[model samples]
Target: MQAPTRTARTAGVLFLLTFVSAITGAALYAPLLTDPDYIIGPGADTRILLGAVCELVLIITNIGTAVVLFPVLRHHSETAAVGYFAARIVECTFIAVGILSILAVVTLRQTAGPDAAEYLPVARALVAVHGWTFLLGPGFVVGIGNGLLLAFLMYRSHLVPRPMALLGLIGGPLMSMSGVAVLFGAYGQSSIPSALATLPEIIWEASLGIYLTVVGFRRPRDAETTGTGAQESRAPRS
Candidate 1:
């Protein structure tokens, strides 16, 4: 029997980061939307301040995790080498957007203080870009990109069990399309169609998190699932 590898472990950890960041990010938006009383008019209140801080953290951590995880997927995938790299490119976009988002809030403070409401339009654009690119964009990409790539490689190469491969296959497109919905700003409104569209995306991400953590943390059963992450070595032997 072959030993467990590092690939498994690395993917596992990446998976953990991916979902934890996602859930946190998604959860944060809820309070802001639900309770506008705290946000609409804010003094230097601790809770209000902390909420924004949490949002910034959520953006940073989520985007950061995405930036890191794509490479892990690329390193592991056998097909769609370009696609895997595209995933990285997409993630970098997310990071750029995340940074801009941080700057937007900081700038908001500066602007809101004086007669800088003129900058409101600029701030809105920046926040919109950040929202679409970093939070929603990468959120959509990571799940489908990695998940599909994993399934393809495992199925085509016979790396892992077929059931796992199937999950990747089914989940991948579902996730990718959901991500694309974000590109169109389907989540921008509170309408039923918009909510319905956004629901798939949230579910897609949540499912990805559950799948990766469950699969990643499991004890290695074969050389296919060894100690650290035997990415290529997991290919079946003749």
Candidate 2:
């Protein structure tokens, strides 16, 4: 009913949408991601195109979350809020590039026809670009933005439970370190260790989304007390 409540609900929905869109998009792209010679083979053009659509949804929801939350977050700390917003923009930018790369692959597949073999290297290169963007965008930038900055704000502002926020505090750095390790070839991106490392962050975000959607933001203790005091002061004289 109120503005803050509406804002929280909108942001929460956006967060959940981001999760859905991202996962669905990645799954839909499996044909390309798993197959190196997909460009030359009978490509799942329609499926791949659908995947690109999901990713476009992801980009929208990703930026929407930041935009919806910025006003509330800035009330707590303007600089951190701005940083988080910027981070979301950067993350979405990477996602957009990745989407374009995949689209290019699809285009080549459709138009290249029998000569697809010649563009095999080019298609693979494009896939590689998408892979790197995934790592850098969702892998690294998400750690800094959603994991650290957003979590810290939620923790400090008492917008959500501290324990929930704590998950982000811990997970953010772990996710970033894991990204770095993957970057340095400590393990493959799809390895068990990488999945394990990503678990906490996944939980943090999922829980935050659920909580904000269901319970909405909690008013700070001081704000509650101040409101009560103001009400008492305005009471009629005995």
Candidate 3:
């Protein structure tokens, strides 16, 4: 039905948004991880710019995802619905981090007057906020939370292709674990272990994005419509 097509399109968009967001984070901040004291111009213009760009992408993507997710809920199983809502909440938090951190970055960039440590206050604050949000907040807290929900939801829902649902289930736990690794790495608790952790997070994003894209655009009718129709479909034979 038309609904399936529309839902599929939205799923594609979610994939696009998340994929781009990942790229932005990797490209921009990865450099900072290597060099803590690196500066662009006077007070680390390069770092601030990178941070802003990443956040900007996230802001736009989260907004897009939020728009599509409402329609998306209509098609999910109860457990899937729960997982979906949890992901939405996580997305919102990510957006909040993007916005707040961006503001902090811009504020420092503007106010800084060649004091090497000038940007540190704002940047550190923003980074600190980011540290909690992305690593502690989204990665560990929300990521794991949603991952578990999605995994459980996928297990319970019979509407999707078994393979696809199973894929989602598999990805969910991995994603949560990736978040944990990312958190540990971001906090600098363990060097090699933390570095190892990020690989999975990125992989989880890519893998999940790929699965959603494939399933969304295919326009295949899975348990979503079957379940929907059953609720609305009456006992005409009786």
Whose lDDT is greatest here? 2
| Candidate 1 similarity to native, TM-score | 0.59
Off by over 4 Å in 3: 1-3, 30-35, 38-47, 66-83, 114-122, 151-160, 174-208, 211-238
Best-to-worst ranking by lDDT: 2, 3, 1
For all candidates in order, the CA lDDT equals 0.50, 0.89, 0.53
**TM-score, one value per model:** 0.59, 0.91, 0.64
lDDT of 1 at 101: 61
Estimate candidate 3's RMSD in Å: 5.4
Model 2 Cα displacement at 181 (Å)? 0.7
Distance from true location, Cα of 233 in model 2, Å: 16
Better of 2 and 3 by lDDT: 2
Q: After superposition, how far is residue 106 of candidate 2 from its true place, in Å?
A: 0.7
Instruction: Tell me the tens digit of each residue's lDDT in model 3 across 3-112.
Output: 46555456556757766765676466644433444332334446546656676666566556545544544455554565566565666676577557655655555666
Q: Model 1 segments beyond 4 Å from truth?
A: 1-3, 26-82, 134-136, 179-238
List ranges where model 2 is wrong by over 4 Å.
1-3, 221-238
